[model samples]
Target chain A: QNSDASNEPHTVKKSVLATYYHRKFEGRRTSSGAKYRAKKLTAAHRTLPFGTMITVTNPDNGKSVKVKVNDRGPFSRKLAIDLSESAAKEIGIYSKGVAKVKLSYTLE
Target chain B: QNSDASNEPHTVKKSVLATYYHRKFEGRRTSSGAKYRAKKLTAAHRTLPFGTMITVTNPDNGKSVKVKVNDRGPFSRKLAIDLSESAAKEIGIYSKGVAKVKLSYTLE
Candidate 1:
């Protein structure tokens, strides 16, 4: 049984350290732990530790929001981060779908 | 003693049942419980019970993903639901700040 584990293909590779976008869905859940919430100003970075704060900015409108890194994601190839519906609207990203954004870590 | 509790400004009001968008931060955390992860294909809604599954569809690209409603949010007047970074990219919501989408509650 242990031999088969090594034979499995490691499909997980880190893409852009992180990316940004509006509200949409296109990923799968790998862990079965507790769920995360969208209403809270939170985000998911693959490498960032949980509870890390990051500033998310909308390049188009120049609107920015500080979010706590609570989860992990952007599992697909087409998008980056998923904004809560409210976060997208607050930064003026909901109209078009996805926006150019920059996420910077906030020192705790 | 309890009179002040209810007298306190009831600023909390329901907005749009729910909404959609890309990666951004524009809300606040109401609870101090365990944090939510964005990369886990999860979302936050005000009324959805924990573990409720919902389908988030990107109206622009027509991509959809199923997510579990695990938190509450959109505390600001700007956004609706927040997406995980990965989910946004998968559904093509990362390019735009936010997308026109529909969230349907899945019957468990």
Candidate 2:
């Protein structure tokens, strides 16, 4: 749960070691203990403020997905944000397991 | 908090005495205790199963808003559902304070 993303607006956008969650975690709750649906534009971060919106871009595919930080963890110093399955697929990163992503913060 | 809805699919559609929460309730938690944003498509119910999807229709304007049951109630026997302020306004019922609405269920 690294919260290094929000030091400032300048620091908010960076390359992240990102990965998607497995199916077993779907029905479990995180911050609200609310279940996460793979289809929802939501995600988990070590800590960038829950509900913070992050637009993740995959430079390889030139695809992007804007997701809300609703849950927590990738549980590593190297791993930054954990995207939902659909969010990961939105940028063509699901099968790769882990990918470098451009993450930027937004209020909505 | 009348739950006259959901006896069956045939009974899922009915007119309900609906009202919305005041602005003061925005930061408070109901079921999850998660703060609510007025713009989210969410609402409270007496008991229709949490996360249940409800489509509320305002017959006067022929407008409808689809909301998910996330919070819990108006706490009155006569009032059936409590929409969020935005959801109330979406169907043009915010000004009325209270109104009769046709409620329907959907899986999403």
Candidate with the greatest TM-score versus the true structure: 2
Docking class of 2: incorrect
Candidate 2 per-residue C-alpha lDDT over B1-108 given as tens digits, one digit per residue, 9 for 90 to 100:
335454443334555444454555556555545566554656555435566666555454444556666654434334433333333344444456545544322111
- Across A1-108, the per-residue lDDT of candidate 1 in tens digits comes to 113345543322111233443333233222223355333455654334466555444433444455665554434433333445544444444665445443221111
Stretches of candidate 1 above 4 Å error? A1-108, B1-32, B78-108
Local distance difference test, candidate 1? 0.42
lDDT over C-alpha atoms for residue A42 of model 2: 65
Question: Residue B31 in model 1: shift from native, Å?
Answer: 4.1
